[model samples]
Target chain A: MQIKSLNDCNVVQMEEKLDALTSDEVEKALMGLIDNGAKRIVCVFELTEYISSAGLRVLLVVAKKLKKMGGELVLCSLKPLVYKVLDMAGFISIFKIFGSEEEALKSPQEK
Target chain B: MVQGVKISLFGNLILFLVKATALPFVNSLAILSDLGISCVALAISIILYYSIKLADKPADPFHNYGYSKVENVCEAMEGVVLIGIILAISVQAAMNFIHPKHTNMPWVGFICSIISVVINFIGAFYILGLAKKSSSPAIHAEGLHYRLEGFISLAIGISFIISIILRLNGLNKIDAFVDPVATLLVSFMLIFPSFNLARSAFFKLLDASIEESSKMEVIKLLGKYSHKYCDFRDLKSRSAGRKKFVELKLILPEDIPFKEGHALAIALEKDISRNISESEIMIKVEPCGKDCHYIQKNQRCPYL
Candidate 1:
């Protein structure tokens, strides 16, 4: 999956679903974005379903990356069952989630 | 599956006899019209039972898609039957309006309508509970059938009682007209449920996406992964009831060993399974290149 960079913020709009292999590619893409000074990225999951532990670990890495830079990461558009898994893993409270892609893009965070 | 239908079948039979037998004796048009709907309900229940049994069967070499569409077909057939019955009653009721007869046996019909209503209510509640427990489309359709029958019966009872009230004031002709008017009213009741059932069954038969929310969730997950990967594009999915089949293409680093990349795919599969139940994922891990799009779209290698 490709992470398209937004002109307005460090947030990246992911265009596909993330699994272990996909998450690795996503991590590599995030590393490139992080190198480009992209901080406090908002990840959009508009076309994605099912995130495994490997996928979660990738997100955790991104969260860690943002934390070191005093930035944040947010997730949006999780289905009830997927959201349930995230909830079970205590990820809901850890990440900021908006109801929609547009809302996640504009989620208020400390600059 | 057949057992569920048998229960509904017996319930509908009782409702029909109560309405049909009592309505003519009581000289109430509305109750008689309502009674006609019971026949439709019974027909639908029998069809539903057969369809449920068929749909519940596992896929075979002859039918790879399983038998899920059987339920939808049964539902659509039920809708058609309902429409036909409603039209027949309307025509019959119109004939009665042209030659109205004095009704002295309305009390008898009224009692019968009451019995039908009680039976329908019990049947609807029972079938609805079973539908919920089994998640069977046929059972749900059966419950809806009884529920509608119950409503029609109530309407018929109310119309007759009004006729009775009017007859006491010496407007005997008004009592004669109640049955015809009730027939027209019952026809209107069938319209909504028939249209709704037909539409849902058609959609299911077409294999249309039944769960948009789930798809969106999947999309969002893919988009999130983009932060780590690049050149990810082209995702497709189809749903078979509760099962979701997903296919996608992703770009992996060329330097990554083939074994590592294969492992990555396996890991991603696990993630998808964890997030969505009964999911199958097919991934094509491609290297970032100008020919990638062509390869995905045309399946031809420009270099070759």
Candidate 2:
């Protein structure tokens, strides 16, 4: 896990683990970050092997929370296989994703 | 779709005979329910087959999107049919509860239930195996239908045995409750897959995206190439079926003739295709002023 802060309340984190995220873990790690003053977050994955539906569900919940807060959550650096799963589920439009962590962080931040 | 139906129809027809004959002798609601399921399965199988064949046809001038949604529509219809069958069986079973009858041929019902369970199970497995081997949505739906049918048959069998045991214990009303409950259970199972298939097909027909991250990947990859080629002007993209459509605008230096710009576009397209095999990219070349903003946005263009 790699977490970095950018301008204002924006933060970016990367996770290389391909394991399915339990709801508790999602709430703990991601909700914890949001509560700790991350208004906008970008989760980048490098060296990730896969992202199952369970992981996707967690991301969906997180994304919804961020949206409710008027903040955005982006994802970046997805492996091909992972990308395919996201594509098949038609989630590409729901989340902001970039090819690189730097680019994702730089994308039109508010405040 | 036709092939799927024919196979299902034949198999169900055989099951229907066994169940119908046992229904009269044993007067078992479970057997009757199984018979009803077999009949519905056969009917839906036939409907789905023609629809699938039509849906799989190549896109013609009139319908550019092709007929893929036919399978989904068929699946949805089949789901509706299953729901109706279940509801009818449920109502009938409930009525039977109010007016209990003497079932003298309990032994025949027991034998029929056993045969129905075995045959339906085998049929479901055979169809599902074929479905898994081929990515035929129709077959998948059909196979699921059989699976529910098999489950219903099994439930009926258990109900008969339970009925006999309960009859001895002076609780004959138990058998009256089994048919409706079994029908309802099968309905829920069959309808769920049908609803799911319909939703997927509805989205597919609307030309939904492959995945969210893949779309972003496409945008990022295209943006990178745009900066390398020239000052990025415009980027537009869409997805249809299994292919992606990408169009990007880049301004080449005025000094570079049309031939050079065209060559650059070809090279970039090749690079993109090589990188993403599933993409069908279209890049538009535009001549820009020497003071290109892309140079400031990105340090240099190696492709240039």
Candidate 3:
């Protein structure tokens, strides 16, 4: 039940299944970070399993808001199941996906 | 499994004979009522023996659903017959309140009732264990019936012991009333359980859905795996005898390979069935077919 929110670099470590029941909590945490003027986010899904449609909706909304604010939402270390769902939902082409948190952290400077 | 039923059959017949023997030597309506139920149980055990055999038969061309319903039929029929027997005894017990026949040789009846109680309890526990191990509808029904029989015998035994103590203290007049009161109390206690047996049979016959708690467990599993598929609908469930059935439509991605879809469907079924015993699950895996909103908008959706 414990979800550690954005740290010094706006990196949020996600865990477990993110479905209809849990998507709201995740949305709230991510939205809070954006509202507090935090940007250039890195979401690490090393411990995450799958993201349902509701979860995808949360990502889509946050990613769109971040883009409007001239910021970016990056994802890394996605399990196969999460990857398949995001790819199927057309989210693969929307956000910057990386193999690890270090690669995601270096992407902003590379850009 | 058959061994358990056979033991109960012979054990109940012996208890009935012992009670019948004590009935002639004593005058107690409580003992009479207990003996009456013994007779009913004997008949039921006989019917149940054959029903178990028939119920264990595998599904054939003639009976695609198998013979499990035989146990339900026997339970309904037994319940109705038991209610009738109880009603007759309750009336007789009421008459005894006015006439107040003196209870004779209550000590003998007390001893016989204690013996019946012990034997019934032993047999009840043994059969119940067998029922759990086998998971046969017929055997489970038998175990429940035996447990009820044990309770009745225990009640009768307590009544007889009280009557014997009353008579010994020269409270013969009050003791005369004890038997009838005990009979009426035991008869009323038996009604709800008998009615419940009949009601459960009817529910199963009507193909009632499983309990809500069990359905919730299945829903939780679906939620955990919701990401694999787009959406699911038409979650249906039912029960026949001890067997549970669950059917639903699983909407997989349109481009998902057939082999992966099949494996996902099988895995889902296995996970669900593990929570429900004696279950059969059927899932229809279908392509999204423009089901999602993005697909309908002709967006960059994979399924589209």
Candidate 4:
């Protein structure tokens, strides 16, 4: 994963596969970004091919942490398989998901 | 469509040649299986290119629905091909496990696999982007195949590296088993995605409903104007390729004029169109209360 600043939002671009093996690294990196005062985060999943339950847990943790800080964690550009998994896990209603980065950036934070 | 086919064909050809050249030098079953997958991918790309061309044809007198289903057909074919390749690789890997052979030129195979991974990574990225923009299932399947190929190549490269390390430490027997073990792993990895692709294509061929979120969006749009009509019934929806087909029946009071009911249906259709731009909506307005005989006979309409 790579973190970059896009306007006011911190964009975290993910790699191809996010399984159990790579989820820990991702979680740590995201936590480090949050520690650095990066409040509003937009996770860009354009390159993510597959995401396992462990990856979902990482996102859930980040969402909870960001919510406590009065910030937001939005997701964008999920692949069909990843989207299906998230929807099946009932996380679709919990998180604000957009079809593109531009849409995610334009939308307000979920309360 | 032609351009995507050409790109895929050229990319697969290059990767095939590179991997095939390394196969003879390495004598690794993993590289051989990877080469086989690339061969299958090349054939699939050619078939998909032609299928896309056929699918692009406009609707005619004989076939009013056009040739959009050709994409689904091609996608299903690709899935079948992958399954066949997986089976073949698995058999070969099992045979190799029973009688292991030493792999030569591990470094050459490693480098070749690395090169293939890099090429496939770039190819899959662009192909997936194109698939999303055009909403082509064939292209999307091809993109996913390439992405998996990249990971498979990387795994093969790692196995080669591990075997080389083992050989250096004087564990030659264990090193010999690495090729088949890696091949088996790669073959097993292909099962899930191929199955998913075929299953989704099958559902589309069966004319399944669109995703739940899209359905909810349509229902929510209709719910906004629930008070305008006496009742809404029999809302049905299904998706074919990039298009969504929706059919609904709206019941109105008998006192409402035909023109007003027509206007309401048209307005509701527009609202649905605004919500789902790719939808083909059909709204039927039926007079309710005294005019609906079914309501009079059963004390209620079946849809109501």
Ranking by TM-score: 3, 4, 1, 2
Please list the Cα RMSD from the true structure of every candidate, rounded to 1 decimal place.
Answer: 9.8, 9.7, 10.6, 15.8
* Residue B270 in model 2: lDDT: 73
Which candidate's TM-score is highest?
Answer: 3
Model 2 Cα lDDT, one tens digit per residue, B1-304: 3555577778877887887777777766656666776777777666766766676588799887566556656665666666676677667767766775656566677788678677777777888887665545567777777776667666656656776787788876675565455545555555566566556656655655445454445444444443345444344554443345566676666667678888878877776556543467788888655443334455443345
> What TM-score, to 2 decimals, does candidate 2 have?
0.59
Error of 4 at B109 (Å): 1.0
Interface RMSD of the candidates, in order:
12.3, 13.0, 11.2, 18.6
Judged by DockQ relative to the true structure, which candidate is superior, 2 or 4?
2
Query: lDDT per residue, candidate 3, B1-304, as tens digits?
Result: 7898899899889988998999989867888888888888889889988987888798899998787778778777778888897899999998999898887887798788788878878888999899888765556766777778778777777878888788779998898898898888888888998888878777877877766545655665665565566657667787765567889888777878899899999999999899778778999998866544355555554322
TM-score of each: 0.64, 0.59, 0.69, 0.67
Candidate 3 collision pairs: none
Against the native complex, each candidate's DockQ, computed on alpha carbons, is 0.05, 0.07, 0.04, 0.02
Best-to-worst order by lDDT is 4, 3, 1, 2
Poorest stretch of ten by lDDT in candidate 2 chain A: A14-23
Point out where model 4 deviates above 4 Å: A1-111, B290-304
What is the DockQ score of candidate 1, to 2 decimals? Answer: 0.05
TM-score of chain A of each: 0.84, 0.84, 0.88, 0.95
lDDT of 4 by residue, B71-162 (tens): 88887887888888899999999999899999999999999999999999999998988887776778888889889999999999999899
Better of 1 and 2 by TM-score: 1
